[model samples]
Target chain A: MAKKPRKKAPKPTPKETAAKAKKPKHPDMEIPFLKNVLVLIALFFLTYYLVGNVKGYKWLQERFIEGNLNKLEKFADLTTDQKYQAYFRFNHQFLTFIRDNTADTAIIYMPPDSVLDVEDKKSAFYTKKRSNSVQHKTWSTYHIYPRKLVYDREKEEIPSFDQYTHVACVDGWGYEYLEYDVPKQQRARYQVLPRTVKGLKAMNEREKNQAQ
Target chain B: MTLIHLIVLFLCGFGLMNLISPKFGLLEKIGFSFPLAHGLVTLLMLPYDLLGIPITLTSLYIPQLLVIAFVGGWLFYKQQLPQAVRIQDWNKAKSFGFLSINLPWIFLMSILGYLLYVVIAKAMFWPTISFDSVAGYDFVGKMIAIEGKVNGSMFDPDLPFYSIRSGYPLYVPGGFGYAYLMGFDSSKITTVLLILSTVVMYYALLLNYVKHTMAALFTTLFITTTEYIAMSALSLSNVPHTFLAVAAVVTIFIWMDKRDHRYFWLGVIFMALNVWARSDGIVFIAGTGLSLLLFAYQEKKWKELIIFGAVSGAAFMIWQVYLSGTLGITNDGVFVDHLFWDGEKFDRMTDLIWRVITNTQFYGVAMIVIPIGILANFRTIHKQHYHLLIAILVSWLAYTALYYQMDNGGENFGYSLKSMINSSYKRGMFAIIGVLYFYVGISPMTQKLSQLIIEPGNPFKPKQ
Candidate 1:
């Protein structure tokens, strides 16, 4: 009853060996439901704790959650003009005022940046250092589109400088170009006046007359 | 009515996508429709404005409807109408306990939803106020809408008040014009929709290579890039251009990997639109072109290379012809005619680029995460995605080189080269951020990690 010679197991072919390596270890293994749940919970908590400790997280939370969301909610009830005003402030107001006062086809004479940037306590116009929105030609044109703007610097370049239909008076710069005198009380810091030139006075002439 | 208009636009894009290829997934179809439709609309408006056709909502809508009809008729004739998802499949998916099995998805979805809501609300609640938009794109768009012509008052030489940015391509302005023509009070809706389309398409594209969980996770990461998300709410061309560039490169990469002709054609369309979004988008085109050329050489497919180069370069050529040939506008002299080496300029550009790219405050964990992912999978990197790596590197180098060669001495529109680097260049990195995250998402290491978490004991594999 001696055992017959034991048969050696057949060697795995190359294809079988490769397939075995590729196959999942536990093809029928059930998902470890509790383990996955616990791991996920740990991961969520870890991420929460890690992100909470970062300095950037506070800024993000404040900027996006507290600040932007609240601001958006508040803005929900405002009109489009109010919303524009909130962002553009006085720039929008001035431009809209110009739009209302001038015709669509009117050519406006704008003050030079130098004049607009002058610091006058009694007549505070936009300064380039403080704000460029109103000082920016394209920005102003966008606000009052279909109306053209010309500056003193462009006076030499633009032959139609003398033909400007209106003057955007800022810091009383354009008053000298006006034909009639605006009474002291009537003159405001910012005004869009019709460019009447029946008796335009040069600054030098006014200075000579004052000296006399 | 706005909703109806949006629906029409989406359908128009959906029909176009179906006509291009009926093999797209549901999410892919939904994600790509709005942008394709929007891009086509902007392109259509160009010819209309040039040919003296009044750009009314009717004018745009009728052509789109015809597209839909033609797609439907063609598909019906070919008997290749797209198969709808069956109810039984939905039931099977519903019964799979997806919620319990994929908790990461829930977390990622919540984050993405919150960010999207905030961005959309911010965009909708405010009018266009960004300086560039107000002075340039929005201004031109407003003029176009009011005058019903592209060559209207805004382009008058006598006015001379329009910003240099107004001379850039008409995508953003046309978008604004389209919104206005649709009777919307605010053009910000277009911005909002574009953002939505970008996010959706990004996620859908990721799903092709990764599982749902990984796709959601990386897509969340893509949107959360701080400066990018901040700028997303503003009506700028950068964010939208980012979408086109990323779509083009990624689709081309997918085509390389899958050898699918549909992806190839889609990639070509996006690459063309990339330039239409902004002329500088040619950097992306050049980058992807090199990749395609390499693929063609390796596979001996010269015809595909010819097709891609000719089609992608068409938009750039057309835009140039319009600007210089048709309008007789001289070159702005932004770049030097010949390349020169300035150590100071090179160093300054690279230093700033490094600072911007690595600044965690701007890019969150992406700059850190991407490198770590690459290193972890370095052994298999060459085998899987060397083409994509080359594309990213070449495009980035070309972009930086362009800036280096720019004549930064004179200020244009109050923007010096230094200022442009800090702002425009910083914003332009949004495209790179997107493509990098996408690459990392498809990397083998990420796939393995995803499997370990989602289903332990299962072998790691790509979704395909």
Candidate 2:
């Protein structure tokens, strides 16, 4: 009684199954070996990019030179690393100080340096609450604020006594912004504070420490 | 508050995404990608704006957003869910080597790098201080975040020196408003997330067509590492525009492959979003939509083509009407100054833009790679990959023409040209990413690549 012979299944080809895969030839890659090496080299550079160039970790490492910075919670407490960031990381120390501490209401006196860290200036604005009435200057070296005093108005040698609460000075050696903590209504004279600041030694002790 | 803000926004976004994802068949198409996140978050502001939903942190707005979230969530859960599989053996799982070498790895690395940068940038930089951030974009964003809606007082020209662009879109601010509503404080966080969503969504879009290795390489080199992309990814209108552009192209690519209407809907949504982001997005949407129509016509899908064309045209027209009504159609002012281009001015701008292209920064590698990739795979571009190329060319050519024709109406032709180039050339040149993506797709020799990188009897490419 006729059971037709069962059809045999076809064996799968190696191309269709698990086998050694062929190396693709890109038109951009005339030589696969060279392309592989180049790709590896590119990968190395990419790894280097993540590790070296970002500067985020480098700045962080400088912060933690030998088991430290854990206690440096306050910006005032961050003296050692702060100065290091100033001299080393292009005024990031001073910038960080301005950013974390400088309130939007604080009238700050910043030095004239167009080439300063623009990102730093931008960061300082985070401390600010956007005021609709006060139109911000777009590309000022000083942070976005209602009152940005580029220079003291008197034009004297020591500059005139003014109402700036902070003096952001960037001299030949490094940068530091000396903040005067005084009563809100009363303006602090720049000529009467302790010459030495946080034991790091203020850059311009005479001018910076000039408190009255 | 920051954590809570992020969590609430995340939930709202994902819920909208779930609804959107199911509708578009995006999850079904891509097998669980994060394109939905980009789709939802960037898009959350739209319905609010269009439907006159005032953005506030109060129970009123919160409840509205949640209603959407819940409805979406309900639909998502109610759908035909994937059959649950019992974990019997660990032997069937793919190797780490295969997984690590592909597109997801690139996305993982880029996301990690972005998070690291976001942390540092958040620590170091205030986004509001950037020029564009201060001038036109996030200034309003700051307002919306704090005020929970547009502060009409600020926009009052009668005030002293009100400097915000009147015609600028509110998505950026509205995006930030969503954040502040969730109780987040900083605008920088919103900026960071916008940039992050952009890269993630673009990465998902890349995986739609390209081999994983190639997709990873293109993303890292062209989209992720480049400072222009990194910085501009969330800056102002740039990220939104990029997202919509990427989504539109990828959706078309998906539609091309699957011949489905669901992808068409997503593509149309993205195009609508593009027009909503920036005025220039009109050109991009029109170009990509036109390219899609041509593709549909080629495939002889008359119904699909006509439907897509009608929907997109209607969306564009509606937005145009709204913009004209509110913004006012200007003739001899800011709008007219840009619209009219003298031949001499065009020539001068052409020279300037040529110089800009030649002296590319941050994206210099892409500038070189894109041209070479195109030339090397000229055959592939002409024959097999013309649709994507057509999209790129249309967008690039239109944007390029825009840059040339847009004059500040200055007497000195040179300064106007230079200024135009300065403002636009970098952002406009972002259209090159499309050309580069299509090139990588055609160039990678992907079948051979899958075999080399993936394991034998690989689940991703079992037939090699």
Candidate 1, residues B1-464: lDDT per residue as tens digits? Answer: 98899889888898888877878776777777887898899898779878999877888889998988898788878777634222343454555543235556667778788888888878877888788888777887787777888777666666567666786677778888888888888888888887888888999898888777778779988888877888889999898888889999999899888888888888899899888888999999888889888988899988978888998899888888887765556456777778788887778877878887787777777887899988988999889987898788899888887787777765433456678788889888899889988889999999887677666545545555
Candidate 2 interface RMSD, angstroms, 1 decimal? 12.4
TM-score of chain A of each: 0.63, 0.23
Badly placed stretches (over 4 Å) of model 1 are: A1-32, A53-57, A118-123, A126-131, A159-163, A179-185, A196-212, B82-101, B328-331, B411-414, B458-464
Please, what are the lDDT tens digits per residue for candidate 2 over residues B278-306? 66766666567667778767787777667
Clash count for candidate 1 is: 0
**Overall lDDT per candidate, in order of appearance:** 0.79, 0.49
Best model per TM-score? 1
iRMSD in angstroms, per model: 5.0, 12.4
Model 1 chain B: ten consecutive residues of lowest lDDT: B82-91
- Taking all chains together, the TM-score of candidate 1 against the true structure is 0.88
